[model samples]
Target chain A: MMKNKKMIILLVITILSLTVLTACGEKKPTLNVYNWGDYIDKEVLKEFEEEFDVKVRYEDFGTNEDLYVKVKQGGSSYDVIFPSDYMIERMIKEDLLVKLDKYNIPNMDKIDDRFINLDYDPANEYSAPYMWGTVGIIYNKTMVDPLTKWADLWDEKYKDEIIMLKSQRDTLAVALKKLGYSMNTRDMGELEEAKAELIKQKPLVYSYLGDEIKGEIVGENAGVGVVWSGDAVTMIRQNPNLEYVIPEEGTNLWFDAMVIPKSAENKELAEKFINFMLRPEISAKNADYIGYSTPISAARELLPEDIKNSLVAYPTDDMIKNVEIFKDPTDIIAEYDRIWTDIMSEE
Target chain B: MKLKRAAYPYIVWMMVFILMPLLLIVYFAFTSGDSQSFLDFTFSLNNFKRFFTPTYLKVLTRSVNLALLSTIISLIVGYPLAYIISKEKSKRQNIMILMLVIPMWMNFLLRTYAWLTLLGRNGFINNILAKIGVSPLNLMYNNKAILLGMVYNFLPFMVLPIYSVLTKIEKNLIEAAEDLGANSITIFRKVIFPLSLPGVITGITMVFIPAVSTFVISDLLGGGKYSLIGNVIEQQFRVTGDWHFGSALSIVLMIFILITMAFTSKIDKEKEGGGGGLW
Candidate 1:
């Protein structure tokens, strides 16, 4: 009986190995692309796969930190990844990314000059801009006055009606901007003041939220909230009473960019994928579908007139003059970590 | 000896999957920096020291309090239901247990998310209240909401074990107690309750352990306004990239759980000893 059991196990193992071998024999060269959830049009991927005749293995990540951990752990070999500005800077510093071969990506010229050579990648050598947005207040116009300043979020009348971003940097930026301080301020005192102001505002906050912020505002459960401009645009479309504004004090202007990781085995195919995405038509489809600002100026022309004129998506230069792109906080991350812990842990 | 040989695969599985990860957690808990390699090591008590401050202690206390409250509430609700099920016919008992287990088969996160829609300010409950001319009650994003999530999710853990023990109970003991001129309440107190102590202890441990370490339910139902100990450890690992501190907090929690187990098992042993002499 024991020998028969062993024979059956051996048979099963042989069948498994045969299946694995057949799977490997029929495989095509694959390019692994990782990006934010629901950030791209699915049809663009199908088009790229058909045109290139290569298998496109697509994955989505919830946050920049999740992407960082996956890359840093060396568990997965992704050829292409999309990470936000601060994360891109951190990756470049850690030598986790390969410099982009700009000559191969001829479509780079179509990208607007304003987005090129940004603070995160000053030389524009390591990454290409994918989407850009600003952090701002999205409010229910019926429940709240037209908010022009970040301080308006702290009004007592909106007690248990205000929603704040659960993220560390974005929420802290609101307090910093309200105080007329730099959003990327590294000064310990400024940070402490921001922490204090947030704790004081904690009681009035309906909740600290991430993606759920949109649902709350759209449902009119929250009077106002700190929201990503792109998300605000989408929320306004869902509920007409919702309005988005870039607070007068300005906010964090952030960018998500495509970069080839150092671990990538298919650099050339990754570059091809990037170039295809940067094409005005593909970029416009993505921007229009996702409701985010596209960096390709040509893509902007192709966007419908209403979306093209959206102040939330494409803020005027005057509105963004006081804005700051987030810098990597490697120097005082411990302080930021402590301050966030303090805020969350406080009664 | 043959039975012991049959257990070899399981022992090896436990060592590789359970023992190794625990050893890694301990190793990470002692180290200070972001050193990924095993060779260059600097050991320190700073991670534990950092966790003992008033802010983190408050979070730890909150986690314990909430977990204890949920465990107690689960027991209060589960014990009676379990007792009733135990008294039912054998076929009905299986059906009732199967009904309880059905929700557990669904994803825990999806089940918790469903509660958000049911309890949100603009959710179904509030909508019904609005139609009835009552004001919308602030239901979601509060301590009570979090407690509801915990109890709802972990109630099965509390019930199943107790039900099993209650069913396995020897019928002769209750008959003997009744024959000794005991009323129903007196018979229950003298025989069945004492016999079910083991299951109650198991149920408490099962419920409390998971509830204390839960972060998702709090994040979803509590609205991230409240930070439990699990949330702090999750923050350190996921957001702040401070694995050393996260590992240290995990070690502390493991020790806390170990102590609770020791206390409960001692009670279990004493009861067994007291009952053994009579048996």
Candidate 2:
């Protein structure tokens, strides 16, 4: 009986230990990260996962709007997101983001001073800059005449050969800049004027496009196209026949930033990840990989000479000195949206 | 009791997924755009008022026109194909149905994206045209391209329902008509076409509703220039952060779809009651 009792106890003990071990061996905590498509280097995610001993779940959204809707839908709990300036402003106003604890992110000093404390997040809270670039006209060298201003888009010579940005704010901003007004003009009259201008210019535009603008430029489908500087960088490198110019008329100098949402389950992990990304080597690698300008000042040295010195990548200080960034339009956004929808619907 | 318990989870799922969302939309439709507070339900007709703008009405009209066009095209293309398939042997019929369904296995979005590359200015078709010493056709970023996409994607919807109804049709009726000295055209017009009325209605309802509310096709092929009701609703909810307006537009769209469905179903009933003899 004693021997039998011992065997029973031993069996129970072994089973209990096995259950405990199996439970402990289950999946690691996953860090849910949402970012723009093709915005990150693949190896960098792997590196972060290995360094942190946690699984990384990365997802992509096509636009700031997509990112907002997905986050609002509550279908998934995302820890970190990368949204552009105006979107960050909207998120901040909506109270969708948490006030980031800067103490946890000590590498903040590495960011270029010029990128710090801008219009979107003036106090340097809630967001950390990831990449900085401008919205400008990228032109085919041999096909188009000399271009210097946003008004050049309306030139008759480039009629049906000019591609415009499909975006609401970016396209509207072009007309607003040409009119020598703020891109974030809340004036109803000024907005009406701007809308009229876009409508008048619609015939000259070949097609209002998004990413396909690059392919169109490279294929010589369009003589000139409105594009982001980072895209221009990549396109310029691919074909030497392309040249990017920040229009003489002031344009948008936008910055995209990393932020932690209030719904993040792993807030500490998110901060750690942001700090990890802020490390000089990682920032440089990301900038080099994405063809976007590094926000970190120290990372410039780590970049290849060509990328660091590329005119498209690094614009002269005068170009961006008085440029505007998008603000959270709030109720005024409806007007802006109305203009875009109306413009598209016009026959 | 066992069956009821088994069904409990499904009921809960329905309530959570379907009924709850509908309720939320109804609630949002009537409320103000400032949804920052739980008690901020300050109700208004502003969303409805805003929707009636000339611009929005134009978009609505365009959506209806395109949806109607695509439905007609699908009927013209799909009805013949379904009839031919129904005439096949059962073994061959099954294979033909499978072949029709196989293309849908990839994805609707992927298929639409494929059209983007094929119809683009420097795309394959344009390349071929260039090689043939013809100027490349300006095909992309237009209504024609969107119509093509809508017809291609929704043709399966048009075919499947008609095919199912046709296959169910008894052959003896057709044979009797033929034995009575009715030719193929007379037999088809008198017997087959009348019976297929319900299937035709179902197919139209399926294809028209989806085509009307199609955002992706318009965005991809229409080159972001053509703004339909779907794109507007999407922009309102996603881009503009205006749920009140989005939900209101959705309700309006829902009403339009519902009216169409009711009209189609009424016609279906009349046909059935009339024994499908109307020309």
Candidate 3:
């Protein structure tokens, strides 16, 4: 009886210890970050982990819409997210972002005033700008005549040589701007006009591209194409023969901002990471690597002269004047989406 | 009671992971709001109304057509390759199939990016064409690119099932057909084809469902210029923040898939009866 009792006690202890060990193994600190693919300098992440001693888990989505879906679903616990200007506006309206404590982010003072107190976060309350760029035409200088305005996309001379952004909002907005309508216009008649214009240009377009637009333009496959300023800058660096032009009629200026989601489990750590990214040296390094215009004024000052002088990074004052920032259409978004689908199905 | 207790964990897992989410989607399909905190419980048909609009309907039809075309193309290309492989010696067959499947082991996004390098104007194919004095083809961001990407991504799915069934087919059956003086074409059509019908059906299902809902390939290769049912549904949820409409689209898509599956299974059952003990 004594021997049997001892054996039973040993078996119970072994099982208890095993259960405790497994439970401990399952607990660990993890920070989840959701951002655009290829938008980050991955080496910086490695350095951050070494310095902070925290496990950083990263996830990427292909589009702003994709990011919005995951966040809106309510169960996702992402610590940090990168969203564009209009998306930030929508998220603020929906109350999806956590208000930042300005004291915790002292480096916030280094950000360019132009990026602060904008339409998305008028008080600079919920988000911090990461990068800003304009939507413009990127062209191979040798093959195409100089592009001056959004109407150049429809010019018969460049028929089948022009590529446009595949995004309904971007493509339609350009047309609307060219037609002298507000980029955020909700008027059904104006939207219809834009739709008609897109259809007219449809036959002349070589293709509609997003990320691939830069590479295609650089390779001389397209004479002129609508492209994001960041990608345009990257392409022009690779091929000196290429030039980026902000259409004289008007173009969309977009800013990507970082925000801490309400569902974040590591809000404190997320704030720290955001502040670190704003450090002048770090911000300048990111701008140099990504080739996107930085929103940090101090960081801009620190960049090499050539980078600062790059026409793609800092367009002429006249060019900047011709650009209009995109605002959240809110109620009229559905109308735009509908018109877009109709146009896509026409062919 | 004892049996029920033993099965409790599995039941709970299924309910929590699968049933709960599906139920939530169905519920949200009729409700409105961005977040759960703001959800209004009033039932509305606005979501369904949006789906029935002519614009969305056109995209749905186009998606169905694309799926059908991809299914047929995959069948034609994959079945023969599978058949040929199945006839080879066992060791060589294993090696060949492994080679075919190796590409799938890489990340899907990486493979899609590889196609960008291959199809771009300065890409390999275009460079070779340019060297030969032919004009560079605009094949990277259009319907042709979309179709090529879909077929490339899904061909393995088609090949695997048909190959499995073909390999299991008894060699004596084909020999028996030849003994009865049936020619090669007649033997294949009457014997091999019927025996492999189950795999062909399975492959069709595997290819069609994914092709219809494929958003990434279309976005990446087609340059997001085209609208498919998947893209429309995705935009509703993500871009417009219209969960109700997105859920409605999802439910409609699910219904369409079920109807197609039912029709396929009915045909499969009929075929099963006509084909003899060739299982």
For candidate 2, what is the DockQ? Answer: 0.55
The TM-score leader among the candidates is 1
* TM-score of each model, in listed order: 0.96, 0.90, 0.85
Tell me the tens digit of each residue's lDDT in model 2 across A1-347.
99999999999999999999888658676788999888889889999999988889999988888888777666688999999998898888778899888999999889978888887788989999999899888888898887889998877788878889888888999999998899988888888888998998887787888887888888887789999999898888888888999999888988899999888999999998999899999999998898999888788789999998887889889777768888877768788888998898887
The DockQ of each candidate is 0.69, 0.55, 0.55
Q: Candidate 3 lDDT, tens digit per residue, A83-146?
A: 9988899889988899998888998998877789998899999998999889888888899889
Those runs of model 2 whose alpha carbons end farther than 4 Å from true positions after fitting are A1-30, A69-78, A93-101, A219-221, B1-10, B273-279
Candidate of highest DockQ: 1
Over A158-223, each residue of candidate 1 has an lDDT whose tens digit, in order, gives: 888899989888888899999999988989899999999999999888899988888888888878
DockQ comparison, 1 vs 2, better candidate: 1
TM-score of chain B of 2: 0.94
Ranking by TM-score, best first?
1, 2, 3
Candidate 2 C-alpha lDDT tens digits along B220-257: 88878788999999888777878888999999999999
Can you tell me which runs of candidate 3 are displaced by over 4 Å? A1-62, A66-82, A97-115, A258-279, A295-297, B1-13, B170-181, B273-279
Clashes of each: 0, 0, 0
Minimal lDDT window, size 10, model 3 chain A: A23-32
